[model samples]
Target chain A: MSAVAAALPLADDALVLSHRLAEWLGHAPELEEELALANISLDLLGQARACYALLGDEDALAYRREEREFRNLQLVEQPNGDFAHTITRQLFFSVWQELLFGRVTGTGPPAAVAAKAVKETAYHRDHAEQWTLRLGDGTEESHRRTQRAVDALWRYTGELFQPLEGLDIAMEPLRRDWRARIGDILARATLTMPEGPDADAWSAGAGRQGVHTESFGRMLAEMQHLHRSHPGAVW
Target chain B: MISLAELGVLRDVRLLDGGRTAEVELTPTYTGCPALEAMAEDIRRALHTADPRLARVSVRTVLSPPWSTDDITEEGRRKLAAAGIAPPRRPGPARGPVPVALAIRCPRCGSTDTELISRFSSTACKALRRCRTCREPFDHVKEV
Candidate 1:
């Protein structure tokens, strides 16, 4: 597969999720949490920019693309429901990214990007894991909300293991490691592990094919509006 | 606030095309560091100010040999502490997500009873920390 084809999925994932996290800029529960979310968002945005730069003009790729052209995971496109939901989303996605980047090897932009990103994703996963533990084991309401969020987002987790077109990753081992890590974190947090996507026949796996959920369109509309309106505006 | 040189982000500088063109290389502290662009621009301006003969100054970002806190020079660490920001301890080796949990010293009172307030701070490279003895909140350059 072409390098652009391979990098597109990873880039799109970062871009979409970065935008989602940035939405919490002024709305986060606390000042420190806002800063943390923005920092993570910036990191993911940087990763996306690096990957996209390798293919073509990064702005054009990010802002000019239609909903059908994006190759990001459907899970990332899901709305940040609440603090717990966002943490659940981060936990699911960060574990997959950390595992995937850790296993990525070879000489290229992807490898170089992965080498640095693996470290960043490790922190992201830890942040998510910490919040998961607090929410899962804290007050009774917190536990209920945390479990509800996890259950709601569980199906989307399966799509993460779905292999991209050009990336040379062992899907089985990646899937296994992801499952084991998620299971362990949930067990520690006093939360029940949700059923695997394999158990349910209709797991999400279509984002790589350029198909996205309904909310993704709205997100893209907001994200692309400024660039779409102005042909070549720059800061 | 330490200079990139002290932080060890600036890698190399070379004059190509018989000194008419200058090429500079830099590695970022993090993959998505926003300061990189500003740093590059600063280099370009500094080069022009120092010597107007150079017709071109190009800044390239290199990712190979990923940067770590160990790259920070002793001078850098000293400056960091002097500026009231705790410098990271020597991160022994690259390991898994389980941090070694080294006791961080407070830059203010020189106390080892500092606690992490947040894993992240104003920038991606720093973490928010507070000291028990001094009771002063400060930023700690994370050991990555």
Candidate 2:
């Protein structure tokens, strides 16, 4: 894979996550959660935009491309299952993101973009952990649901760490370090990791190769509809 | 309007506009536009482009009374629209111009019948709203 192959997926992950979080904007159970989710979504969108900007600023390159152009991990494109599912995804992804960002921020990538994303992901990780703990222990139903969500999403977690073509070589060691850090946090939280076929280790190749689950098609249909329909539509 | 003289940004004791450099008070587009740096840079550029001689100009970033939809002026709305921006959701009821409630009109669909789906949009400065009629998501302009 080329830099674009590696980069689009990174940007797609953030952008998709941003879209899902955007869904929970006013609809969150509470004002604080509402604000928090919105904030998280905003951060992710910012990260995605930065990633997109770096990859290709051309509207066509970013939004007008076909479904295969997106290279985000399946975990990100996964539908926002129930709230539990969504939170589960967040818990798992944020842990990884936080960890990756923590290490990357130390010294890797461009100082401006990477540093900014690193700071934002730190908050995302914190926010996700706090919610996981809350939902994991708050009530019987919430706890059970979140735990189940953990179990379901666990299968996809491995993909987050599997090295891919064109991945930032300098960031490889940090990515490994991130896995360990994420592992420690999950253990302390007493959260159960999911089990299933490795979403990231697809024999056909993972999302990094632009091979995605069915959900990506639908996501692209909706996301790309307007831009495709009215070429160059802005504002 | 607080006097720049109080902030010591004024060059002379004169109270007239020309007596001092143009005051540039910066407000985030919504709540947390993250594009603040870009916006700030834009303002500086706009100022410089307008008049390079305007030195000692003061640009203040005030977060107080955090931006609300209410702050959107008629002129701002037009500029936002012309810029292809979905203007801020009108303050008041979430639905279409409640006439009494003052909700924003949707850019995706001109329908005033809109409901705020989220108080936060992709950016803090904008809130997410859905047009009841179009079911399309739109950005509500924040007061800032």
* Maximum-TM-score candidate: 1
Error of 1 at B21 (Å): 0.7
True contacts kept of 1: 0.71
**Where's the lowest-lDDT run of ten residues in candidate 2 chain A?**
A104-113
Model 1, A1-235: lDDT tens digits are: 7545678899999999999999998999999999999999999998998899889999889999899999999899999999999999999999999999888888777888888888889889999999999999999999999999999888777678787776788798999999899999999899999875532355344788787888999999999999899979887
Cα lDDT for residue B19, candidate 2: 35
Candidate 2 lDDT over B1-144, as tens digits, reads 222222122222211256346566664432235766665566567666777666645555543333344555666666665554567545555556445645677776577897866545555555667789988776665442
What C-alpha lDDT, on a 0 to 100 scale, does residue B6 get in candidate 1? 95
Highest-DockQ candidate: 1
DockQ of 2: 0.07
TM-score of 2: 0.61
